[model samples]
Target chain A: MPVASLREVQKRFWDSLAGAAGIVAPELADAVVSGTTLGSRARLGIYADAYASRLIDVLREDFPRVAALLGDHRFEHLAREYLARHPSEHPSVRHLGHGMAPFLERRSDVPRFVAELASLEWARVEVFDAPDATPLAMDHLRAIDARDWPHLHFVPVSALRLVRASWPVHELWAGADPARLAPATTVIRVWRDASGAAYHAPLDARAAEVLRLLIAGAPFVIACEAFTDRTPLEAAQAITALLARWIEDGIIARIG
Target chain B: MSLLPHLGHGIGLRPPHYPRVADGTARVDWFEVIAENFMIPGGRPLRVLEQARTLAPVVLHGVSMNLGGSDPLNERHLGELERLIGRFEPAWVSEHLCWGAYGRYYAHDLLPLPYTDEALAHVADRIRHVQERLGRRILIENVSSYLTFTHSTMPEWTFLAGVAEAADCGILLDVNNVYVSAMNHGFSPHAYLAGLPPDRIGQIHLAGHSDAGTHLVDTHDHPVPSPVWDLYADAVRRFGPIATLVEWDDRIPAFEELVAEAERARAIEAEVLGARRQLA
Candidate 1:
């Protein structure tokens, strides 16, 4: 044998090495690979095992809460299923499980609870590495004139992510009983602390609606007007509570 | 093309040991970070990198450059690597000679490449593109493999030398990989080392491997075994105090234990180079 066709060889080798992909292109595996103490196919099996399991290990680390709820056998089943559906296209293994939320949702055996938990975990992962920025101090807000207050728009920190789930993902992630889960819709805010730790908390519906509008690049007046049916006092109290929590958690990047 | 200095014995900068290194409890001449690990936007890893940099130099060691792939160059990957280089200003950046990706899927394992001229040309072109985009010559390390291609026209060492020469890049001589591959594929480690050009060597890697009776896997989990340490001595005698790094990615030890492993390399370097001086 002289020179192997690089294109044909790689196509076949990868197709065969990827056992999860389920297609065995045999030309390269037939004649190109040399057998040793271990058979050629057995040798390739080592790499195939590593490729599938390495990414599974990455997912296990990323979604420990989901794994805990699903149990090791069930979680490994979903992970292998996820791997078969989504081959890692990213350079880093950190992003290998980017599609876990949607993947879980698409699975017939995976419960809606697991999908929501995976979403919440992925949000935490995104917030864990998002760029850091200085939060808005009270002076930055108080210095503004009363007239400009209504027009003020908040710049949420780069790490802020809103995960809306059909179940209480925060409690489930914090070790709640999955079997006792009630069907509920909740919007949770996940953010990185100033000290670089990640945390998530549930938000009230009215306040969460306001935050949703703000996250969509809405002005303070419009966001506040989202609570149109509420009384003036109730609206003012909700906005005050939201801003206090945002500021305390260091999620507000700027207000102008 | 080599413009970097010899950063003596070092350890792969791992997270478990970050707090100690940042707080000045651990000491090393330098640190080698997995480039992909720190390629993210910003986080504790970047902060720890900054803290570690203040103490000693850092080198970027990547596992996924995919130089020998048949697919088109991943411009996005290159751009992220360039961004990381601009921010960290690593003393040197190195990747493997094998390809980890092809088409859209990345294996994440350093897969083997056939040692043929076609492969040499293709990988050389990829390396040139990488060097041009990054504005710096990078080092390429030979990877350990379980099987070799039947159609390989040349030896792995010759192909490594050819790729480095053609691409005008430096060589990151991984002695542990050489020992592991030599043991696996029935090759002479001495011949492999002799095939490499002395001037092209920019760094050295010392690590542990797992023996499975028939073959050895380059698992950097345990301590450097006796055979690998002997290979390191042989390398020090030939390369004369190159930048050596201890890689224990799995089952990582305490900071002091890792430092002691690095210091072991320092002691071996002293013993090897001292004998060379006396013989001369």
Candidate 2:
């Protein structure tokens, strides 16, 4: 028999290890040298096991809340399913869970909140290592000229992310039981603080709308328009309060 | 005799030890960070890495280069790595000698390669490309494998040495991997070591492995076992005090315990080299 080319061997080896159940082809198995204790199949099985376990571990780390809710056995199952459909494309394992939340969203078998919870978890992961920026200080805001306040566009930090879910996923992330939860639209803002700690908070409908505007680089006046349902004084007060909170949370990066 | 500096003992800068590293408490001669882990834009990992570099020299150790793969090199991965090299100014950079990706898909695990002439030339060319792109020679570390290709025309060490010589790069001799692969494949660890040109050994890695009954797996969770320690002593005797690191990726202990592992490597290296000097 002719020796397999390097490409042929890699393809066969990868095919054998790619699936959840490693099915080593006859040609591939024939290529491997069987040891005294472990057979060719068993030897290939180690890579197969590692292929699943290592990726599953990465998913487990990225979505701890989802894992906690699913439990180890079910989480492993879900992770395997996720991996089969979406083998990693990026060189880094950090991006392995990029499709996980959406994958969960597409599955009808999983609880509705589970996908949202995963989205929240993945946002935290994204914000955890996002680009660093100097957050806008409250003193800086206070130092701004009153005339420039309306024209000022608040630049959100690079680490800030807004995850919207149909379910109150923040509660689920906070350890609320999934079974006891009710369907409610939730907007969670995830960001990294100055101390490099990742944190998330649920935003109210009005606040979420304004934050969305701010994140989109809208002028302060345009963002405050999100509170049009309230009186002008009330809207002004709310926008002031929100700005203070954002500045404190280190979500606002700069004033452009 | 090695081209790289003998930077004393070091440990992998894992997440669990970030606080200590950031607070300027975790002290070691050097740190070996997973290059992929720090390839991100910014966060605590990069911040802590900055702190780590301030405290000790750091080497960028990557797992995803896929130097032995058949696919075209991922330029984005290389660009990110080059960015990291420019920013952190690591003491040196290293990657595995195995392939991890095929085409668009990545295994994320260091998959073994067949030690044939074709593979040797292919990998050597890729390593040369990588070295030329990075503008610096890299240290390629051998991976622990559970199986070997029957079509392999040469021993693993020879293939490794051939790649190093052809690519004109250095070798990051992983002693634990040598032991694990030897146990799994039924080869002499000493012979594997002796096969390599000692001058090409730029660094050494010491880690723990788990016995899976059928074979030993390079788990890196447990403390460096006695046999691996013995192997480290042998490595010290051969390579003579190359920059060594203790790798504990999973089931990480406290920072102090991890430091203790590095300290142990220091002790073993001293013992082996001291005894060698006595013989002379």
Provide the DockQ value for model 1: 0.66
Compared with the true structure, all predictions reach lDDT values of 0.86, 0.91
Q: Report the lDDT tens digits of candidate 2 across residue range B1-280.
A: 7779999999999988999987899889999999999888898888899899999999999999999999989989999999999999999999999998986799999999999899999999999999999999999999999999899989999999999999999999999999999988889999999999998999999999899888899999999999889988988898898999999998999988988999999998889989999999
Model 1, range B1-280, lDDT digits (tens) per residue?
A: 2235878899999989988766876688999999999888877788888888889999999888788889897899889999889988999999999987778789888988989899999999999999999999999999999888888889999999999999999999999999999998889998899899888999999999898887899999989999989988987777677988999989999888888899999999999988999999
- Judging by TM-score against the true structure, name the best candidate: 2
Query: How many angstroms is residue B268 displaced in model 2 relative to the true structure, after the best TM-score fit?
Result: 2.1
True contacts kept of each: 0.73, 0.96
Worst 10 residues of 2 chain A by lDDT: A16-25
- CAPRI quality band, candidate 2: high
DockQ of 2: 0.91
lDDT digits (tens) for residues A134-200 of candidate 1: 8988767657676776778887898999999999989899998978879799999999997678899
CA shift of B93, model 1, Å: 1.2
Residues A60-136, candidate 2: write the lDDT tens digits: 98999999999999999999999999999999889999999999999999987898899999999999989989888
Where model 1 places Cα greater than 4 Å from the true spot, the runs are: A1-3, A19-24, A32-36, A226-234, B1-3, B24-26
Give the lDDT of residue A119 in candidate 2: 90
